[model samples]
Structure formats: structure tokens, C-alpha cells
Target: MKMPFFTSFILLVLITQIAIRRTSYKIESKEADFWEKERKANFTRKKPLDNLNYIKIPLDSLPFGKLDDDESRYCEKVIRSLADQKVVNLTGFTNTDLKLEYGAPNITELTKYDQNYTTLVTNLQKWGKLLYDAELYNEATTVLEFATDTGTDVTATYKLLTDLYQNKLTLSDSEKKEKISALLPVAEELRSLSKDQIKRLLTESL
Candidate 1:
């Protein structure tokens, strides 16, 4: 026996309502659980941070960053200041990870250390561009290469390096291609939101 159309429609509505309620319940439960865990994490005990890797800038090597210009001099000053700072690239790590490893209390310090590296990479890109803009191709290459090799998540560093390799540098076509190819993994490994832009820059620039 076929049910009436109105009866069928009412049944469908009931089923849809039930499904919506269930989904809403699950979402609420998940959100509640996440906050509970986060609350607990805030009280986590302190832990040693010795296992964390820190970045130490090598100032003696990068002598090609500045020339007879104010911009380059200012850039060098920023770079030199970072040499003694507590710098680290905590790119992929989250607040939860930091709390778990270094404890909640140390999160502020760890964040500041990461910020130092952020400052360093930002200055590195700026310095490299300053050199390039000054027509110091070799000097720009030195600075940009250092930034790239340091695993900087700053996309500008990668862009400047790509520009150097593809256009500015005296390397042959094959050499240029090889250097550009090397940056592919570096781009893929970046934790920056601008990584796609860097990847596109690499591909289209060549």
C-alpha cells in the first residue's frame, strides 16, 4: 500500500530534522572537547626547551650585503643585530605543540624567539632586494642564497632568489634551471601562507 504524499513528506521532514540535530550535537561536543583540552594545556607543567633547535646567524660570512648606500647600511645594521638574538623558526608548530613541549608558561618566550627569526628573514629579504636594487648582483646573490638556505618561510626571500637565478646571475641556462629546481622542495616545505605564490613565482619566472 502506498503512503499518502503528505504523510511521506512529513516523514522526510522528521528524518531531516533528526539528522540536523545529530550533526549539531556532534559539532557542539567537538568544540566543547577542544576547549577543555586547551584549558588543561594552559596549566601544563614546565618542560626543558633544550631539544628545540635555534638559529644562529653567521655575521662574518655575509660581507656582501652593504655598499656605499644608506639603505644597505641600515639593512646591515638590522642583520647584524639579529646575530645575537634568540632566533628560531617554529613555522609548522602550533600553540598546542608549544605548550606540550615547552609548557604553557614558556610559550611567550618561545614565541618571542620565533619572532626574532621572523625579523631576521624579513630583513634578509629586504637586504637582498636592497643589494639587487643597487645593481650589486653578486652581493644580492650571496644574501638571498643565505636566506633561502636558512629555510626561511618568507616568500619574498624565495622570490628574490628566483629573480637572481633566472635573470640577474651570470649562470648558464642549465645552471640557472638547476638552481631554480633546487628551490622546489624548499617552497614545498614552507609553512607560510604565501607558499603558493612562491611556487608560482618559481615556475612562471623560469
Candidate 2:
């Protein structure tokens, strides 16, 4: 038997309410769990961070002056400011993880380390793009390679490298494929939201 139109509408509304309630419950559950973990995190003691792998910026090796535009010069200045800075690629780790790893007291210093890493990676991407835009293919690759080696999770960095290997750089067919193939593990290990996109791009390119 066919249900009346009003009866069908009411049934649909009821189903929707049930789904909304379930979703709200899940959200509340997760929030409660996170808070409980955070409370534990506060009690964590300081851990040694002396063994961190710090990234060093190769300022002299990178192509820094092909373009004299305002943006290019600004990026160079920013990069130079980081010459003496400490950079560590802790991209996949979260705040809670940091607190747990190095204790709450050391979070401040750890945060700075990560901030420098982020700053360097971001500027590297911009600098590389600027170089690529100005037809500085080899120079762009140098910048991009440094970012890649430092474990940047930025998808654009991977994309730029892929483009250069395939079309821009003067590499043999096997060499091009080989270089791109090496990026798979790096992309696969990414915890960034863009991980899937980077993986997909690399997979298809290979």
C-alpha cells in the first residue's frame, strides 16, 4: 500500500533526526576523549630533544637572484633571515604529541622549531615557483629538491618536481621515472590533509 504524502514526509524527518542525533553523539564522544587525553598530556614530564634532525638552509647553493622583482627580493630577504634559524620537519606530529614528547614546559621551544621549518618550506615553494615562472628550470629544481628532501608535505612541491622531471629538466626517460618513483614513500608517509592528493599525483605520474 502507498503511504500518504504527509506520512512519507514525517517518516523522512524522523530518519533525519535519528542520523543527526547519532552524529552529535559521535562528536561529543570524540571531544570528551580528546579532553581526557589533553588532561594526561599536561602531566607529561620533559623529554630530551637533543637528537632531533635539524634542517640547514643552503642559502649559497640555491638560485636566489634570477628575478629582481619585489616579491622575489622579499622572499630572498625572508630566507636570509632564517640562515641562522633552526628548522625541523615535524609536519605529521600534533600539539598533543609534542607535549607528550617533550613535556609541556618544552612545547614552546618545539613550537618554534616547527614554525621555522614551516616558514622555510613555504618560502621554498614560493621561491621555486618564482624561479619556474621566470624560466629558471634548473634553479627551480634545486630549490624544490631541498624542500622535498626536508620532507615537505606541500602538494605543490611534489607537483612542481614532477613537472620538471617529466618536461622541464633534461633527464633521460628512465632517470625521470626513477626520480619521481622515489617520492612515493615520502608522499605515502604524509599526515597532511593533502596526503591523498599528493599520493594520487605521484601514482599517476609513475
C-alpha lDDT of all candidate models, in order? 0.82, 0.89
Please report the TM-score between candidate 1 and the true structure: 0.81
Q: What C-alpha lDDT, on a 0 to 100 scale, does residue 141 get in candidate 1?
A: 84
Clashes in candidate 2: how many?
Answer: 0
- Stretches > 4 Å off in candidate 1: 1-30, 204-206
Write out the backbone clash pairs for model 2. Answer: none
TM-score against truth, every candidate: 0.81, 0.86
Residue-level lDDT of model 2, residues 109-153, one tens digit each, is 889999998998899899999999989999999999998888899
- Give a tens-digit lDDT track for model 1, residues 14-102: 99999999999999999998888788778899988887778777787786435877777887898788887788888878887788777
* Candidate 1: residue pairs that collide: none
